[model samples]
Target: MSDATTISQQLGAAVHQNGVMNSTGVLERLFSHLFHGLVYPQIWEDPVVDMAALNLAPDEDLFCIASGGCNAMSYLTARPASVTAVDLSPAHVALLRLKAAAAQHLPDQAAFFEFFGQADRQDNVEAYDRYLAPHLDAQTRAYWEGRVLGRRRIAMFARGFYRYGALGRFIGVVHMIARLGGVNFTPLLKAQSLAAQRQFFDSQIAPLFEARAVKFLARRRAALFGLGIPPAQFDKLARDGGGDILPVLRERTRKLICDFPIAENYFAWQAFGRRYGGAGTALPPYLEPAQFDTVAHHAHCISVQNRPMTEVLTRRASGSLDCYVLLDAQDWMTDAQLNALWEQITRTARPGARVIYRTGGAPDILPGRVETSLLNRWRYDQAGSEAGFARDRSAIYGGFHLRRHEG
Candidate 1:
């Protein structure tokens, strides 16, 4: 088998063994591994939505999963007292570390932009080998040393940010499929008017859902599962649009494709255009610079462990964390796991600590749990949380926000 396939197989086996995909859990292990190990730390849920949900104070110390590290670095812009980012995947950890190194050590903002936004420039490997390589921790250094398609190293984003890696290739394939369907989505890059953009969505994109190819693809439980939807979540996603998931998915895809200028949205640039920062301003951070120093400074506060969420929480100090940002991770847990996680959160959370997560449907998954006196100290912000949910475009989650009450 090819090296890429080998890696995927190994990862799949590891995920299955880890109980990440047990049938009784809320999340499918295989799906979570694919999303977290492969799809995430590339194009993930938007930081803007995360920022809105976090409502972080300038001085609050924060802890979050580093998925792609974009949100971690973006959190720095808010001038938080500190931000700790953690992730289980080594690839994600390496990427986050590299970004942190670059953000802190890079010469200037413009050069930083060029390196990350214009990653196709060809000099990026040298830049990493020269300026960034020596500083990388051994693990991250070894990660970049690994080859892509037998190429020596994956550090060649300088030639083009979108030209390398599995994520890039995945986006390319999606774009190719969309193109084959007779939807000329390229104009989305230059759409200056919302009217024009909306026109594109209504005309060329939305109709794809009703197409045989899309519907067929959507019906496959495995295919949807690969997008990180577990069986329960698959049901929720299907029910959210009043029993027709195809239309809802199509509309969301249209938003990613036609709602914003490609330059402004790294997700679209990566998904439909196969290049980031085509119009000059860098796409968001994950696709921006591969090295981020600002994210690293807060790295000490972040800790990545192979253990499950319940285990991670049990080890933390009580009443210490102010916010818990669980990125649909709960969807992968069992009732026992859920109860265990909440027990830790309740013990460790200070009064007024906030917990946020996303689900696969319009309704909150925690109403029964949160309302019961067992974990009832946490109250739900039904209205505000719903508004936040509606605003999220990832369309992969049903959003929720919970606040801990004072005793």
Candidate 2:
């Protein structure tokens, strides 16, 4: 069968555990099919907070889930010994590989930025052909050169790539809904202070969540699949919201807008403007001009793999890994899956190793779920986790947990 079919099957195995005839099982299968393609053009987790939580040393090797490859690339700035980024989706694997190749082969920061930073210029398609295409592996080359709806997939960069992915389209629909309600988000981006940001949110954005249509959509499990939230995570979020997700969503949006300055939060730019804030403002660490050389120089340190995190760790030598970045993935895991993952993690963790993950609810998901023996091998840093959660620019998750290997 094709790569897409294989990926769908793999994802189905991981996501669909309930009875096939049950509503939960059906929704899980639907999400896996949708996720088999490109879901996150820009990963929602903030890399700045991730790097801080990881606190990697130059000798430390890191492993992470490669959801758009943003955090993996950004980790290069910390000068880690290596970064192995694994994912279940072949599309995400191709995207990350393409990015790593671009970082090394592309001539300069402006050229790289024009391709990914502007992300809506026609020149990028030509740039890909001239510079990045030949360097990519056959599968990756085919993925970009291939057509979607009769348009070359690489042309997505020329036509605004960030607006085309599952999450991007979700944001676009949110904007459309706001427009229908006579609300505009552009003003929020121009706000000079947190006070102004709150004012804009209170006046222009907050009321939109209360609309009957908005509330109805927020209640539907399918509606949030666009946000990359699975049924398992949806349940956690609903429980946190007292069985109504609207309040949870409203509070998260408010934190995204008012908790950080626009000039300092790139997540806000993507959420509100569908693009980065540009040169003087916020950008992912890897995309910043000053750090471009560092990322490119260390780009070879990153390796992309299409597989589950547990499988990758299982093949690794004992005490081989120093850091792990699990971005809200545990919320989707069954107890057995959680135990299996942590077993490998505990076995592979080196001295002073750290692991950071986020959850849909305010508390960490591991304490009561994973095997107690496996979990007792690590010490959870509650204060650092709360601090990390507070500083996370994305502000979409409820908790950020950091654990240190006790061995």
Candidate 3:
């Protein structure tokens, strides 16, 4: 067998066996795919929560994972000194590079929005070829040259890829099954008042957990993990609902659908309507048009490396970062892994640097660990963190922590 094929098989096997990708493994696999040109932008993270956690200032330098580049671009709105985005996904790196190119080179905000938000249009590819392609590094440029879902040289957002990717499609299937079970969610989508929204949620959405299919699905720990819930997390999510999962989930979905105007929330649109209004009309902060210029100028500050949190932290100079958004990645690690991560975070963090993550249970997982002396350089605002955690619409995360040490 060819060495390249053998390597690919080994990597895939490792990922399958490990249940999650580590830093080096992620990097090697990502580079292999980048060389071949397959990518997915737009991870299923809540930017609102992440941005709030950052509490960024104009002079602070930022470091983040460039998952689809949306959050990285969004961070620019705060006017930080710089943002260095790292990722283990080659496709993600290419997308970030392309976004930087578009933000820098696109003549107007409208054009930029059209290419990314109204991605289904063919003109976006032309725009990429004409305006954005030349600026990309060789690795990224070659990566974008390949076909996505059989279409050549397409942007993920342009091909309706965001709505069709693994997470997107999974949500779609869940919506379909819910509908099939006589849960008509149309009213939840159109509710004009929070009262009415709450009513719809209580009546229509909450009962699905008792459905035979949902129970069957939830029973499979492995399947739940794909929803980003690990075994421990699934147990926690289940327990958070007082051993009743349906009511809690229904209420969360109701808030997402009915809390705001359908136009203002891309999350709701993606969840219920399946698409955002075409072409850039004030998206989430991270996807906003006003910040594109800053994102473009600071694109070089981003990097994608395949290394663990410990390794990534060690590479940074002491007191170099302002924020760390873990995105529930910790749920996949062991105590030793957590200790390794904390060691690096404690070492590299500037005084007052924040660390935020979501948990599967309804409480902060690291209070004792973060509050202790060896790491107690950091402090946690239990009250404020709890409030923010309650406000999260995704409802999947149990806690949202913001930790900073006094200088």
RMSD of each: 4.9, 1.1, 5.1
Q: How many clashes does each candidate structure show, in the order listed?
A: 22, 0, 5
lDDT winner among the candidates?
Answer: 2
Candidate 2's C-alpha runs over 4 A off are none
Candidate 2 lDDT over 1-407, as tens digits, reads 98667777768767887878999999998888876688999888988888888787775899999999888998999988899999998778989998899999988889889887888999899989999998999988988989989988999999988998789889999989988999877788888999999999899888898799999999999999989988988989988899877899999999999999998999999998999999747899989999998999899999898888888899999999999998888888889889999999989999999999999988788878987888998999988898899999999998899999998
Arranged by lDDT with the best first, the candidates are: 2, 3, 1
Candidate 3 Cα deviation (angstroms), residue 228: 3.0
What is the C-alpha lDDT profile of model 1 across 1-407, one tens digit per residue? 76445545543432332353555332445454553343443645666666676676676766677666667767665556756565555666777677677666666555556666676656667767777889887867887788777774544665565554446554555566677888776787677776777787788777777788878877655556535555656767778778777766776676665545545666665566665644335356333333344443543444443334556678788877777777776665556657777888777776677777777666667656543775667767676577666665444455555454454
lDDT, model 3, position 124? 82
Q: Regarding lDDT, does 2 or 3 come out ahead?
A: 2
Q: Give the TM-score of candidate 3.
A: 0.82
Candidate 2's TM-score:
0.98
Estimate the TM-score for candidate 1: 0.82
Q: What is the lDDT of residue 128 in candidate 1?
A: 78
- The regions of model 1 sitting more than 4 angstroms off are 1-37, 41-43, 159-167, 230-232, 241-244, 257-264, 277-282, 285-307, 369-371, 393-396, 400-407
How does residue 240 of candidate 2 score in lDDT?
88
Candidate 2: which pairs clash? Answer: none
